[model samples]
Target: MRTSLNLKKVSIALLVVGCIVVIIIAWLNSNRYLPFQGAETTSSGSLKAVEKRLAKLKQAGEKPTLEQLADAFQPLGLIDAHNHNASSSRYLSMLDVWEEYHIDKVVLFGDISEPSAIGTDAAAWKAYQSSPDQFLPFFSGFDLHDEGSLDVIRDNLEKGYFGLGEIAGASTYSPIVSLAYWKASDPMDGFLPEIYDLIATYKAPILLHIDPPNGLPILKLEQALEAHPNTTFIFAHMNAYNSPEEIDRLLGIYPNLYADFFAGFSVYNPDGGGHPEIFIPIMKKYPDRFILSSDSGYGIESEEQAIDAMYRILYLLDDPALAKKIAHDNMMAIIQAQPATMTQLSAIQELASKNGKAYNYDNLSKLEAGKILADAEKG
Candidate 1:
């Protein structure tokens, strides 16, 4: 009886050990397939790996293909904080590219200037009507000097315009035309007390395009930032010509100031290499304050090209989480924080219908699908 009991205990122990061995093997297999977990995915080693791959191609006297480069980094989804819909062709093309690249949302800026009425709020309104979920429309033409201009902005905001700007102080266009031609306005002169009040009251974020490097523009921006503490200001193109240190200083001074990475001289070098070394540190230091934007519109060759440029900039950042935040989270947070009223939505729909642009999502999707398939076959 004792011998039988001992044998039974040994059998049970063997079964448990067998099960443990099976579990160990299964865990090892699962980990082999899931290589993207933990340090392996986020480390600088990943960037180095990409560099090594490129180097190998170069050594072989071969150019690195887009597919190979794309393979080097993980896929990213984006929310473009600044973009233009200059024409119907551009707008529709952008939508297709956005779909292909996994860009879920974009802030569409309208040209209130008469010179290019193609990208006006009406155009954006038409786009919004087509894909309400995909695009957020901002009304431009904020002129404090002209009461009629102010009225136009107010009416549009009341009619469900998402926000105001790409409004410039240093630019050549005037909010109000004194004569038939568009007049240039000084940044200091253009940004008025009433304009701040108007934006603050509406609770809309303003995307101001004031190029820095000039002292007066920076000073004027500071004045505006100081005066309108409650107003959310997005300084476009990473303040254009400002260095990272200057941007850091400005950010430290103004808690309300946010910057968009929208293809500035400092951000991208004329050489094939992007200015990741400059931007990565600044981005890490001010993760929440910085957001990604294509700023692609009439002039850009293709949305794919714009997206690829953005990705090149993004891959330079060592932190994947930080990259994700800049690409999508930061913009989404800003949008979600500012919810439009029911009245605004209703007005937007009415305005969109009045604009009379038919949005054919199915047709666009089908067209894009064909293009994607063709590209895949070529690859």
Candidate 2:
């Protein structure tokens, strides 16, 4: 009878151990802790939550398959803090990619340096008109070094621009982004500081790209940050040419600076060595400082893959709140409800009065003021 009792106790203990192991595996696989809070399912309904898809890729030691990417990003939504080719035919072709990836908003502009690629403010305004909710149209339609570019900036801001940039500040290596016409010698040279302050007065963010992310350009970037503390300078691609440690050091020092964490570079750019995980610690250290971007759907054949790589970067953060912040919250906090300053408003009102539509302008939103000025100019 004692022997029988021992057998029964062993069976019960084994059953309990089996149950515990099963629970542990399930917990590891569950999508509950994913930063993007939603049960986003593919058409098959079998693949739910981007976290699951990312995990499968991690386990298999494989690159992202099209099937593995999310059909639609979750409600939390990604705010693409940096992108180019806005207000152009190429931009229209990429819209479906935005919907599929759940890019809730994009900081949209066109090439400011490349003569063949520069898009006009009118085209940006027209694109914003088509989907004002999804596009944050930044003014980047002119040469940064030109004295006349200030008038263009002032006019567009009065017309309701969200901000300024993807401005080609410094570059020497990129064949695609030739700066023959308008590259700044550094971030602060010539009229760039004045431009920085002008944007600051409107509380606008400017995304500036400076390649070979070390030496003189970085020093000049620091100087600009110090000189215009109010201006939000988004260092493009997290200064893709620098190390994570260097990025961390800069973020520690500059409250006025932020970074567009270009995910494609982190994973695929030969410069960054195919390691998105290397940035995980620094990104976590400065959670609010980093914002995700794809650098104009660069290099990757399918934008789906680009976006999938971004989610993989998010997964490395390992904290839901931190992931959400980098994904969208950080950028949203910067761009949401950026009101036109009283000076900008007064300027627009003056222009309107000259055009014979004098009305009280104290409460006009930036968009409202911009539309009024745009119509007056057109009329």
Candidate 3:
């Protein structure tokens, strides 16, 4: 009878411990949703780290060819404009590839559909804090269906995010899709129109992914483009599944709509998207409309291969000035046009004071201010 009682006592203790463990995990998951959570360093430190990398590159004979530089004295190289979840271990481990290819900047964002994927905006923010110069972080960490999503977008923008996406709007047909479900339904339906207005208010670009590129999606896209003339929408993958003539038509019609031409998808991907050369004429026709990307650096095989495919497209351009425009200038122009707002700078100053770091608030870029504000907020 005594032994039986002891066993009962042991079971109760085990149950109590298990409950505590579960509670701790729940707390951690909730905290992960917060902006800039898990950031390990400060914005100043991040800037210094990138500066050192730049110095090393210069020592290694790397050259800055493009006229537009995101950071002064930094060289202009290929900018991978649509790298999703860039903080993923696989992508982070490939920094050497960025150096080898002379890639100067990458647009970083994360999958925002939670409980299904790495769905926190903090992932991109953390990555940016580590290497602010190498990455331009965009926020898409809110569920489209959530009523609070509008507030989340506005909050992040006010906190100084450079841009708004790589937002997975409608992915009806794609073998490479990471999530089992789409986070957003129709690109123009529900909260997106309001989100576009918020983006326009900040003059920030929103990168959108709508697959199959035809039917009702195209009509809806046109409607959204017409409705939000002030907002800039980057059609992800340059509608890889559609024809170049379609791309030309879209560009000719919508000055507000831009194209994210994923070189990796064009050259590789057995999904039967035509050769990269097929779009060369259209690219030449509308050079400013196109921005190059690696799309999680899939290139069907590896990030390195995807980057190589990008270079191939650059080589085909032949004209250095035109190549420079597509390579980095176009994207930089969109970002630089919007400086850090007075509100953002004020918040940054307050954060800097809180963190015991003295910074010239007047000179901080949106990315820099965002990093500082994020670190302080995390604390």
CA-lDDT, candidates in order: 0.60, 0.71, 0.71
Cα error of candidate 1 at position 254, Å: 0.4
Model 2 error, position 265 (Å): 1.1
* Clash tally for model 3: 0
lDDT of 3 by residue, 220-334 (tens): 8899999999999999887477788999999999999899988887877775364678888998999888999888765478776677667667756655456667887788767
By TM-score: ranked, best first: 2, 3, 1
Candidate 1 residue-wise lDDT at 73: 42
Worst 10 residues of 1 by lDDT: 362-371
Q: Which ten residues in a row have the lowest lDDT in candidate 2?
A: 33-42
How far out, in Å, is residue 337 in model 1? 2.0
After superposition, candidate 3 runs with Cα above 4 Å error: 1-76, 112-120, 176-182, 272-274, 351-365, 371-379
Candidate 2 colliding pairs: 159-370
Estimate the TM-score for candidate 1: 0.66
